[model samples]
Target: MIKNYDVIGDIHGHADALHRLLARLDYRERDGAHRHASRSVIFLGDFIDRGPEQVEVLRVVRAMAGAGTARAVMGNHEFNALGWATPDGAGGFLRSHSEKNEKQHAAFLAQIGEGSRGHHEALAWFASLPVWLDLGGLRIVHACWHAASQACLAATCLDSAGRFHGEGLRKAYRSGTPEHLAADVLLKGPEVRLPSGHSFRDKDGHTRHEARLRWWDREATTFRLAALGLEDRRSELLDDPVPAECRYEEAIPVMFGHYWLSGRPQLLSPTASCLDFSVAKGGVLTAYRWSGESVLSNDNLVWVAA
Candidate 1:
């Protein structure tokens, strides 16, 4: 097994930033794939949508994965893309073709036309990706890393390798099912509803009544303290305890993306770090050099500006 890794965050189709970041990490292009002599990349996903160069990003990432220089987990965007394209068997898509859904997915569709060979291939590749990678010491997941959610998925939607197929894939998309809950928890992170009349506008300017919680923070007892990316409006938040199910109590070093975190890259705790730096929003493309460290450190973070 490859012990050295460069765990990368969400690309969001920013191919230039990704290339620069890979270069900064000393990866070199060879034989149609970016490779490292002694290291491999573990991408946290969100490889498409919301930025230019979606096709290029896919080409590079797919080549590296195909060349065995990189591995990846399915991000929410990738999962959504699969759902949007898959037939629901009820005369509708697994994810509806609503205006909001279509708009959110337009960038990808624009670059890789729907029903084209590229689109179909991308969907198949995404479906093949596992939701999480447990590397004994280092765990890689796209969002929240909760044991209960992982266990739930393992028993239902996920196969022995954490991938979805056939009945499992359908169950993951079915609303109100345990498989759906498991998928959401792992792919979209755990969210808790805000207090009545308390809502915050996200980075995308969308108002959200539900807030993603800081599952890695054991001391975050109140909603204000537990919420991620809502520090500016903490005063308006109610002093409510987050649900116990939302906390991550594991000691394993787990890296994730999908938080759209800004500023300098750093560990959330000794065991948790959010690699996503909002590269699609002019933020940096970030990665953490994992050299088999049992605990994460800030010094390992490497990035390139978007």
Candidate 2:
């Protein structure tokens, strides 16, 4: 077991910055893998896409995890990659290579150059990654950590080894199914539609009516307040807050990366922290040095500016 853990945030393939962050974290490169005396990294996935050095990021992360110096939970990108790679028995991919999906993965696709061996290899490896890690002291996941979704994962997605089984994969990709919702909520966080005619442009300028809710807000009274994170948007919706069932009730501290969070890294609550600092978008790549602390603190966050 890791004596000390550095929970890394979403790294959308900024290898140089990642290397710098590792150095700042005092990790040493030995035999092509980053290591520390008693510390291991818990990668919060989204390791590929949308930044320079995609392959380099993959190489570094793969080496460390392969060398037993790090552990990882699957992010939405990885989960999407698996679907994009799989065959759907109808002469098409499980997740069709549509404009939206392709655009989201353009950087990663450019590196693999489309449907090559490297692409398939990446998907296989991603399928092997667990969706979440329960470390007893804390929990780790890509996004939301609702217990209902966790149970859904157990019943229809994750196998005993924490990997996805073949049957589970079939179940998870089915639209409107419980398995699909579970995977979606876990990987993409909880999302809700805004009031009629309410819409906003995201960081990428995509028009969106659905807002990803702030799962950490236990007492949120409005949709604006319940928003998962801050983003470049038109304005707050000011609608009704998400229902009680939509909020997280887990007591275990959860550290995750997915929302492309910006600004200084900080805890949403004493037991909730977000590490993603939008490093791929010229923000900082952050990590939380979690050393058996039940109550998380803002001071423990570390980063390297991009």
Candidate 3:
């Protein structure tokens, strides 16, 4: 069985950073795909949207994944791309082509051209990615790793191999469905609603009524302490108690991305790590070299300048 892995963070179309990181990890590009003698890559998705090189990033990742050198999970951006391209059985798409949505996806569409063969192929590949991976020794997901949320997907959306099928894709995007909630929590991290009259503007200037929870923080009890990736606005969050359901109590080493973390790449806890250093936002592309250690370490974190 494979024991060594290079768990990578969100790419967000930064192919240069990705290439640099792979080289830094000693992976060589061979036969149009990067591979290591004994190590494999676990890509934490978000391979498209924002930044330049969207198609290039997909090409490299798809080649490697296709050649069995890497495994990947679907990020929210990939999911959104599928929704944007899929018909809703009415006149509109699952994800509308509103100005805001288009603006967010402009870079990818500019590169791949909506409705092109490349776009359809990319969407098909995205549909094939698992929402999460449990490798017995370790687990990987794009965001939060909640058992109940995964169970929801297993029941309504994911096939035995964890990919979404036709009816599953439809239900996964439908509002008020268990599959929808599962997709949201797994791909975009779990969130906790703020107290009435409490809210904050996100990085995109959108007002948010809920804060992304630090689900891995098993000791956190209050919202103020449980908020993730919003250190600047933590004071504005209510000191209200965090719901018990938001806690992550598992012991398996889980490596995930999508938090847009900053600073030197590091483990969130002994068994939890967020590899995303916001490469799409002029930050680093981080990875962790795992050698089958049950407890993760900061020393294993490796990254390249963006």
Candidate 4:
């Protein structure tokens, strides 16, 4: 069990917000010396893509990890980014997002130089990230634990092996390929199946095969979690306890990032929490400090204005 730690949500290349947030959290270099303390940062992943400062963010995080001030898990976006760096297919999400850092990407590629030690080192670092970290009773992952496959579980079960397996998973991040880049789809839940013989219609009365995922709004007259089935494309509201079949229950308090919670971080379930606040979109990057049984919010670490 880490004595005092802070769990941060996805930064998504938001270096400015990350810096601001870290300052608010009182994270500092130990005056040219290394020190172990009661506080450390646990990044929940998604440190790249969909934001402007991927390179800067990477450099800072790499430094922090080297200094033992912080640790990070592998987010799906990072996996996608690494996959794009490979020689195989178009790197999918990685390639598409490379536009944000075309120059840095090129420089990074050049430094690595094909078949050189730099190449191997870069890949090794990317590949060696952890998928999930168990801090005492708290668990940190990029996304929901329920969505994790047996292979993912196997890779993440032990700390040493988990880090290696996580690196391998990052290296294999490609969509619709044999390696399974769509881990989110696998973990989020099965595609909704339409009711038998029921035709699907949108609120606008248009027919569709897929239903949109639901957003939880406390102020809404009807506050509930729902899922859409493919056939009828209709949403069914769930009960308060939430069905055990929903894949929310696990062995520990799972904190993750990936899902954009509109503007606020979501305290989804007592066991599951999402911290991504879209910092790049002028939203806050949040953190929750966990003690024995209480989760404390350091709102001062919120980088963006409300």
lDDT of each: 0.90, 0.85, 0.90, 0.57
Error of 2 at 134 (Å): 0.3
Which clashing pairs does model 1 show? none
Better candidate number, 1 or 2, judged by TM-score:
1
The superposed Cα distance between candidate 3 and the true structure at residue 297, in angstroms, equals 0.9
Candidate 1 per-residue lDDT over residues 124-157, each given as its tens digit: 9998999999898899999988888889888878
Error of 4 at 37 (Å): 3.8
Candidates sorted on TM-score, descending: 3, 1, 2, 4
What tens-digit string does per-residue lDDT give for candidate 3 at 126-164?
A: 999999999888999999898999998998788999988
lDDT of 3 at 301: 92
Stretches of candidate 3 exceeding 4 Å from the true structure: 229-236
Model 2 misses residue 253 by how many Å? 0.9
Query: Candidate 4 lDDT, tens digit per residue, 1-306?
Result: 546667788887777887777777777656532234567778887776666666677777777777787888887665554655554544344345455445435444443354566556546666667766767777777765544443544543325546535434543444565335335442232233334454466533566544333322122222133443231322443234333433544546667776665655557655556777667566788887666454423432344442
In terms of TM-score, which candidate is stronger, 2 or 4? 2
Clashing residue pairs in all predictions, respectively, total: 0, 4, 0, 7
Off by over 4 Å in 4: 31-36, 89-122, 147-160, 164-182, 185-224, 228-245, 294-303
Q: What is the TM-score of each candidate against the true structure?
A: 0.96, 0.93, 0.96, 0.67
- For 116-144, candidate 2 gives per-residue lDDT tens digits of 88877777779889989989988999998
Q: How much does candidate 2 score in TM-score?
A: 0.93
